[model samples]
Target: MRADACRNLDTLLQTGAKVLARDPSASITQIAAEAGLDRRTVYRRFATREALLVALFEAKLDEAERVLDEARLTEAPIAVALHRYVEGIVPVSRQWPLDFSSLESPDHVTEKRRQQLRARLSAFVDRGVDEGFFRADVPRTWVRKLLDDLVKLAAHSNPEMEPPKAADLVVEILLRGAGKQ
Candidate 1:
């Protein structure tokens, strides 16, 4: 694709995420107008609304995979890995707010990637427990869920906060509970 086409696609995807996040029922025409692109352009690229959503989700997943790779969860020290993952993911979550659970029918590749990411995360939590970064007494699933929830909350609740700041807040909250120390 040419530079202009790539730029236009990025604009459409970004604008689609924002508009659809605000209103799931938002129309393609509205998204195109918001993106400053012609509706026909979006139609040319995506055959339907569902196609646009699938592309958006795929873009999000691609970013997530990159973040996970950069974090080096298996090799990095537990604290460092946690912070890096949170910092990297907060922006991606904010940019593409769609929830995978809401997907009507995820392709096999997407589902496989999601499973791989989840397995890696679960393993990281197990490692944290074994390494004493997390208490062994706590359920591993609980810890994983808490971390996921904290990241989502940080991204959505504090939209004004920068990713690093939001990450710091999330890491602090996860490592040390809200209770007075």
Candidate 2:
């Protein structure tokens, strides 16, 4: 494809995501219009609705990573950092479009990102243990898994659920397993 065509494709994908995110029922014509391109141009890049949705899903994941990076997680207190990270993830999960069932299905890229986040969060908990904020006996691996499982559980199960409450429950469970000094 030509450079201009590639640019148009990117524009269409970006604007289409915004359009769908704002109104899950936005039409192809509406998306193309928002991108300042014609329907034919949009279709030239994305052959089907599923293709568009999948691209948008991938874009949303990138946006999530950007949000996490901007959070500056390492500078804050462990609990504070964890809360903010979980809080950031909550809104993303709630906002993510779920109309496309296949696109919403778990993908390798998504799993890898989640695993990376788990590692980072587990490290934070381990740091807390070293600093005496968390119990000494806690396994960092469990802390990591709890962050992944609980935040996701809250997302899929309850959009109206409080993330902090979810975080608290996860923290309590892990701490109990670790036992007090």
Candidate 3:
């Protein structure tokens, strides 16, 4: 695809996410208007609302996967990794808050991507346990779940909160609750 085409598609997806986030029932025409593109252009790219949504969902997963990979969750100190993950994921989670379970079709690729992420997080939690950063009594899976929930809570906060602040708050809260007691 041409650079301009890619940029236009990205704009459409970004605008689609924002608009759809506010109104899931928004139509292709609404998305096109919000994206400042001709309705024919959006229709050319996405024949249906479900197609647009699927693209949006895939874009979100791709972004999140990239962020997680960049965090190097298994290569850094567990604490450092956790902070990086929270910081990186907050924006993606906030901007493209699509519920995977609600997608009409269960996407294998997306599910696999999520599983890979979960594996990295699970390993990080186990590493923390070994390093005495996390408690040994609690199951590592429980720690991972707590961390996931904390990150979600932080990302789900009022968009008014700055990303850095949200990240810091989530890390602090997770550490306080899941750290050695």
- Candidate topping lDDT: 1
What would the TM-score be for candidate 2 when compared with the true structure?
0.54
Candidate 1 vs 3: which has more TM-score: 1
Question: TM-score for model 3?
Answer: 0.85
lDDT of 2 by residue, 102-160 (tens): 45455666557656754665666777677776666556666566666666777667767
User: Which pairs of residues collide in model 3?
Assistant: none
Q: Best-fitting candidate, measured by TM-score? A: 1
Instruction: Summarize candidate 1's per-residue lDDT along 83-177 as a digit string, tens digits.
Output: 99999999999999987754567777777888888899899999898888887777889889999999999999989999999989988988785
RMSD of each: 2.2, 6.6, 2.1
User: What's the lDDT of the predicted structure labeled candidate 1?
Assistant: 0.89
Model 2 per-residue lDDT at 55? 73
Where is model 2 poorest over a 10-residue stretch in terms of lDDT? 97-106
Off by over 4 Å in 3: none
Provide backbone clash counts, one per model: 0, 0, 0
| Cα-based TM-score, every candidate | 0.92, 0.54, 0.85
Clashing pairs in 2: none
RMSD (Cα, Å) of candidate 1?
2.2
Instruction: Name the weakest run of 10 consecutive residues (lDDT summed) in model 3.
Output: 98-107
The C-alpha lDDT values of all candidates are 0.89, 0.67, 0.82
Question: Per TM-score, what order, best first?
Answer: 1, 3, 2
Give the Å shift of residue 24 in candidate 1.
Answer: 1.5
